[model samples]
Target: MHVPDGFINAPVSAAAGVVAAGAVAVSLRGARKELDERTAPLAGLVAAFVFAVQMLNFPVAAGTSGHLLGGALAAILVGPYTGVLCIAVVLLMQGVLFADGGLTALGVNITDMAVVTVVVAYALFRGLVLVLPRKRGSVTVASFVAALVSVPAAAIAFTAIYAIGGTTDVPLGKVFTAMAGVHVLIGIGEAVITMLTVGAVIAVRPDLVHGARGLSAPLKLRVNGELVDAAPAAAPAATPVAARSPKKIWISGVVTALLLAGFVSFYASASPDGLEKVAADQGIDAKAEPHAAADSPLADYGVKDISDARLSGGLAGVIGVGATLAVGSGAFWAVRRRRHTDAGARA
Candidate 1:
C-alpha cells in the first residue's frame, strides 16, 4: 500500500526518508552478491511482475482493498537483498511515472512497504524452512505462512508511522485495529499469490531460484546393499550460448508483465486502495496536498487526452510496464556488471 503525501508529517517523513535511503544503500551493496547472470535477469522480471500484479486489487474488507505487496514473493523468488531492490525500483517508478505513490512520502512507503515487509517476511520464511521438512513442498508452505504474516506486519508498520507523524487527530488505536484487520484479510490473498508464483518458478527451474541454492540433493547410488548419496560435482562453466539465451527469459518475462499490466489492469476494481481508504475514513487526509506531479500528463495512470477509461488505463499500464522493465533491467545489469568486474579483479 502506498502512503500518500499528507498522511505523515514532514519531520517524521524526513526521518523515514533517511532510514529508507540507508536501507537502499545497504541493499545496493548486498544486491551485488545476489545479482549474477542467473539472478540479474530474474530480479528485473520480479520488479516488472510486481508492478503488473499490483494492478489487481482484491477486496480486503467491505470498503478497503489490497494488492500484492510483492516483498515476500520477491524475496522468495530471488533473494532477500535483491527482493528489496526490486520493490524499491517498482516504488520509484510508480511514484515518478504514475504518481501512484507520493514523492514526498517515498521514504515512508519504501521503509514501510519495501524494507519492513521484505526483512520480516524473509526472516520468517527462512526460519520456517529451517525447522520444517526439507522438501520443496516445505518451501512453498513457508512462503505461504511468511507472506500471510507480512501484510499485516506492513499494516502495523503504517500505523506506527502514523502514530509518529500523523497529520490528524485520529486515534492511533482505531487506525491500528482497522488497518490490521483489513490487511489481515489482504494477507490471505498475498499468501496465495506468493505461494503460487514461488511454487511455479521453483517447479520449472529450481536452480535459477536464488533461495533454492544448497537445497538440491545429490544423486543417489547403491553400493552393494547400502545406499549412499553421491558426491556433489562442481557446476559447469558458463557458456557463451547460455549468455545469449538469458535474453530469452528476460523477453518472456517482460511480455508477461506487459500482458498483466497493460490489458488485465483494465478489469481491476475501481475502489480506492488500502492507504487511500484508511486516510479517508480516519480523517488523516486533511493536510494531504495534491501530488506535485499530479498534473503530469501520465498522472493517475491516464494519458493526457484519452477519454475512454479502459483505453487510457491500458495505455498507461503498458507504458508503466515498459518503463519498469527498462529501468529495472538496467539497474540489475549494472549491479551484475560490477560483480563481474569485482570477480575479475579478485582473480
Candidate 2:
C-alpha cells in the first residue's frame, strides 16, 4: 500500500526515511553480485512490468480492489536484492510522476512496500523451495505462497508503524484487524499474479528466472553400490535453436507492459484499493495531506488538459512505462558497471 503524507507523524516518518535509505544502500551493494551483462537490463524490464501491472487493479471485495505488489514476482524472476530495487524504482516513479503515492511519505511506502515485501517474500520462497520437490512447478508454487504471505506481512508492518506514529487516535486493534483482513483477500490476487508470471517465465526461459535455476537436479551414476555425480556435459558446438535471446524476451515484455498499461488498464476496477478503502473506513486518512505533485501533467495517471479519459490515461501509462524503463535500466547498468570496475581493480 502506498502510504500518503500526514498519516504518520514527522519524527516517525523521518526515522522510516533513514531506514529506507539504509536498506537501499545495502541493496545496491548486494545487487552488484546479482546483476551482470545479461540480467541487468532484464531487471529493468521487470521493474517496468511491475509498474504496468500495478495499474490493473482487480476487485477484491464489493468496494475494494487489489493489484500486484510485484515483490515475489520480481524476486522469483530476478533476485531479492534486485527485486527490492525494482519496487523502489516503481514507487519512486509513481510518487513523483503519477502522484499515486505521496512524496513526503516516500520512505514509508518504500520501507513497507519495497523492503518488507521483498525481504519476507524471498525468505519464505527460498525456505519453501528447499523443502519442496526441486522442480519447475515447485518454484511457481513457492512463488504463490510467498506472494500470498508478503501482502499481509506488509499490512502487519504498516499496522505496527501506525501504532508507533499514527496521526489519528484510531484504536490499534481496529487498524490491525481491518488492515490484516482486507489485505489477506488482496494477497490471493498477489499470489495468482505472481504464480502466473513466474510460471510463464520459467516455461520460456528458466535460466533467466533466478529462483528456477538449478531445478534440474544433476545426473548421478550408480557405481559399486554408491551413487556418484556424473561427469559434466560438454558444451555444444552451437546454441540450441529453442533457446530464446534476451532481446526477444525484452521486446516481448515491453509490448506486454504497454498493452497492459495502455489499454487493459482502462478496464480495471475503478474502486479504491485495499489500503485506500481501509484508510477511509478506519479514519487513517483524517490527516492525509494532498500529494505534492497533484498538479503535475501526468498526475492521477492522466495527461493534463486531455478531455478523452481513455487517451489521457493511455498516454500517461505509456509515459510511465517508458520513464520507469529508462531510469531502472540506467540504475541497474550503473550497478553492473560498478561490479566490473571492482573486479578489474582486484585483477
Best by TM-score: 2
TM-score of model 1 (CA atoms): 0.92
Q: Candidate 2, after superposition: displacement of residue 345 in Å?
A: 1.1
Predictions in order: lDDT: 0.87, 0.93
How displaced is residue 25 in candidate 2, in Å?
A: 0.4
Give the per-residue lDDT digits (tens) of candidate 1, residues 104-201: 99999999889999999999999988888667888899999999999999999999999888999998998998788888889999999999988887
- Writing each residue's lDDT as its tens digit, candidate 2 over 121-190 gives 9999999999999899999999999999999999999999999999999999999999999999999999
The candidate 1 region of ten consecutive residues with least summed lDDT is: 242-251
lDDT of 1 at 123: 95
Give residue 1's lDDT in candidate 1 (0 to 100).
81
Runs of candidate 2 exceeding 4 Å displacement: 240-244
TM per candidate comes to: 0.92, 0.97
